[model samples]
Target chain A: MSHGVHDTAQARFAPGARVRVKPGRPERIAPMHLRTPHYVRGREGVVARALGRFPNPEDLAFGRPGEPRILYHVEFDQPPVWGEGEVGDTVLIEIFEHWLEEA
Target chain B: MAGTPLPESVELLDKLVAALKRRGVLVEEDIARCQTQAERAQPETGARMVARAWLDPEFRALMLRDGTAAAEAFGVAMAGAPPLGVLEDTDRLHHLVVCTLCSCYPRAVIGYPPHWYKSAAYRARAVREPRAVLAEFGTVLPAGVQVRVVDSTADYRWMVLPTRPAGTEGWSEEQLAAIVTRDCLVGVTLPVAENARIAA
Candidate 1:
């Protein structure tokens, strides 16, 4: 049910906004083409930049027009992406609008 | 075994292509054309882009701002492919790109992904232990430089714009590009000036 925010070509959550990956769909039971990695699910990060409107790859893979979604470059710290000491390393993952919520 | 067995995914692709062919949506010529195009998609385009960017700050800004446009400036076709994202390597930060889910690379600019890049080990360990991965590739970074791993998860493909090695001030673009290998753009290794290598 966490899929109704991307109404505009350029939807909510701009760059520099703190956001968390949404754990919307259950991956194990059904066949889904998801771009959000499980390691980042429900984790917090900052939006590095908006990558303009793109058809949801999940839908495109299934041969659908996939109503455009705003894609953003989300940057996460290395600690939560994995359990490790502070290495000062960070990760940047491209996530669609529907998979993210303003933190 | 004669060779490694193809995964079920390969069979699925075959089935999909067959279905499309049956429906007249795909043809043999299309596949041949694709193969030809794939042959042309080498890392040389990316290397030339990096070399030009190293010498021209304006091109570097354009590359960072709009990677597809920069690639197009090099005459690489950018018709239906996804946008490109160029991550710059600075004195304090290094970028290593991985597709955790699958191998999604900037094929238009940098050719196909390497075998190791698509392996499950690289995909998993790159995010979990990037520093270790770089070291295995013989890239030992100083402690001060931060390691940044980029996951090419969605629509935009990623490549690294490596820093120019010192002592190449008067080098031509072709000479500069000659040192930029596919691994350098992949962020596993760096382009070292021959003099620096010899001196070290």
Candidate 2:
């Protein structure tokens, strides 16, 4: 079976890569429909795993070709996210490559 | 007979369904069959997998490695569904599943998701304040144990394999499976031996 929407010759981020989520504008203010969570924007996390390549849902939702984007499982510290919790706790999100930058 | 009025979204969904029917995008018979399959789904499928994993180390390894294949080996059909990933809860770590974008779930294995799972509050709070969310569900983990909230996005779906509760040693697989509740699989609660009495 096909692994994902499109096959990429190489993955953008390898496992354990440190990356930061781009702090894009909120959906109400943004021009495009973004699938990344608002709360996670601007946050730093580690690439937990490479979840393969898939069509960018943000573009796909609008009936565009979507192209292929590398999806990574990123894990963030819970305390940094929630502001008062177990430090060991973490939140993991599947993010598209476009939403990430090397930290 | 009178009944509650359908929500605007429901009405919109009806229109969408009617449109799909007119366009032949969906057949009535197929919709009915799908509804039947959804209704027939049970948490027992996940329970069986968890029970087997608990009993056999090799099966547990397989489940951790490839969840979909392990599930199919046990006769759970996963056709047309996204890939399945099983998260194992250890002594130091716990895993919770949520879909912030929408209510994407492992319907093939766990059946229909609970209504609360699809709520905006859950989607928002799960990523922002998961500890509080879990506390609201009566799952207060110890301070030292780490909680990991996994977002189900794109082509992968996740389920939690909760750590086996105490006081159930030497129990049969059937007995163990009895205590494995849907909430446990969702990572919101732990299976208790007390509840197993009723489940048995």
Candidate number achieving the greatest DockQ relative to the actual structure = 2
Q: Model 1: per-residue lDDT, tens digit, A1-103?
A: 1222223345688779999898755768888899899989999999987777777778888897787788888999998667883468999998988898889
Q: What is the per-residue lDDT of model 2 for residues B50-126, given as tens digits with 9 covering 90 to 100?
A: 99899999999998878888878878777776778889998899999999888888777788888788888888788
Give TM-scores for every candidate, taking all chains together and pairing residue i with residue i: 0.88, 0.88
Give model 1's TM-score for chain A to 2 decimal places: 0.83
RMSD value for candidate 2: 3.3
- DockQ, all candidates in order: 0.56, 0.61
Sorted into a CAPRI-style docking class, model 1 comes out as medium
Off by over 4 Å in 1: A1-9, B1-27, B195-200
Clashing pairs for predicted structure model 1, backbone only: none
